[model samples]
Target: MDRNLGMDFVRATEAAALSSGRWVGKGDRHAVDQAACEAMRRTLGDIDMKGVVVIGEGERDEAPMLYIGEELGTGNGYAVQIAVDPVEGTNLVATGQPGAISVVAAAIEGEGKLLRAPDIYMDKLVVGPAAKGAVDITLPPRMNLKVIAKSLGKEVQDLTVGMLDRPRHEQLIREIRQAGARIRLVSDGDLSLALEALDPQGEIDVLMGIGGAPEGVLSAAAALCMGGEIQARLVFRNEQERERAKQLLGTEDVDRVLTMEDLAWGNVVFAATGITGGNLLGGVRYTGWGAITHSVVMRSRSGTIRWLETHHHFHHDPRY
Candidate 1:
């Protein structure tokens, strides 16, 4: 892991904190994402790497921020590619919900591949390496639950599934309820759900849902570094989305079995800064003195995971 390279991602997360939830999202999600995107783009420029947006917000016509394939940095030395989720949970921040974070990951030259994903739907299922091949989205939800339950030496009712709280998942919710398995519904943020799947000893046993295609790929990257498994199938219900996907993916088989290596490819670093409250990590805390922040930084090179909780105390004067 490049120690200095990690700082670029650190700056990106810090800039994401300056968004709508902090200043942009409450009433201006677009502006908030834009600000965060610009902040991320500029911060990346400060580094000594030539980078491009492999996974990011939306398309150029659909939205602003960091669109897919959008090149970043100042075209300098040391070619590097990035997959970033500037604001992983924009709606959560805008509506004052939970599980909002600023996340970014990168890899060295020739070790990364651009994730050309259009704004389409993708069915995702993920779990740690231990639970690999235990959960299959193609099968019925109940059958999948039972498979995971047996693998973990737990009852079906004891398994917890994390999913996006969207109307499209009504059938999945019903199935989970009927199957008697526990369900953890989240408003926004697929990366966290993916990470939950990567943590076997954690709360979530499986992550299954329909969300952004780029996010699915990014989650696959994290899962790859953590020795996890994920399966994704792109869903294009309209002509525009299909055309956009073809243009991006250059293939018709979006329903491909993609491993973790396929997602991130080579060595990477994953780091995130919380923006709101949640179960996995606490939200940013503030007080009369200054503010405090919590972060989880991981480097695939050394398999080191660091949980940093910092407090900053400020005085009226520049120096005491």
Candidate 2:
């Protein structure tokens, strides 16, 4: 992949964020997602790449669906696998909550790198570089927190874990609290939570619990680029999903733990532009010029993470 491809990818995210930012706090969830996906798909079609979207994990009932095998880009440049959550937190955007984002991740297509996971639940444990390889997902939550705390040279009480506010995390939350670490539970957008967990100066020290499998793959790409670690395993809701997983993943056992490489490998490019104010980046702020957007772009091969603040001029660009 070209080194400058990350910049092109960020443009798509910015477009999504800019379009969707208008719908924030509008109480229209579907419209929020539809606007973002349309803008993103349009922007991606102009990029110089032959890209296939590997994962479209947004909840179909809540937001507009982007087909899993949809072909993107101009189809004339790098062959890549694309994964997107054009609006990671539709409800947040609708309700005027925080942490809504537009995310895009890509890797070389047909390279057997980025995992095309079945749309199911995935249990994940993610941490930053300091605690990389020091925590294990299979271990007890308290035990893992202890190890992570030790690695970061902090007490357990000083560490903060991020998770989705779901019933399935009840036991996990108990264990984390028992271990003396604090918790920050959000309504949605696990990808943003995972990214903040990887940030050295970010408030989230770890991210633990179950989230959508497609989001897990998206998070895995950011992990590869940001020197973070994620350990995950597929969680089947029923026997039918298990059979479908067998068909989709072939003989690869879903019961096995998936390292970051197994989820998303190669020189993956990950980009996210924030739509609402949150932990990872600031929300899109409109101005007389057009809008000001904040985005982060990263690449695994170069280990370069760029935080870009773009001022879109409506008169000059007219894409808005």
Query: Which number leads on lDDT?
Result: 2
Clashes of each: 3, 0
Alpha carbon deviation, residue 159, candidate 2 (Å): 0.8
- Best model number under TM-score: 2
RMSD of 2: 1.6
TM-score of each: 0.88, 0.96
- Tell me the lDDT of model 1 at 239: 81
Residues 177-276 of candidate 2 have per-residue lDDT tens digits of 8888999998898888899999998999999999999999999999999998999989998998898888888865779999987898877899999999
lDDT against true structure, model 1: 0.72
Model 1 residue pairs with clashes: 19-24, 20-24, 20-25
Off by over 4 Å in 2: 58-62, 110-112, 318-320
Off by over 4 Å in 1: 18-21, 60-64, 312-320
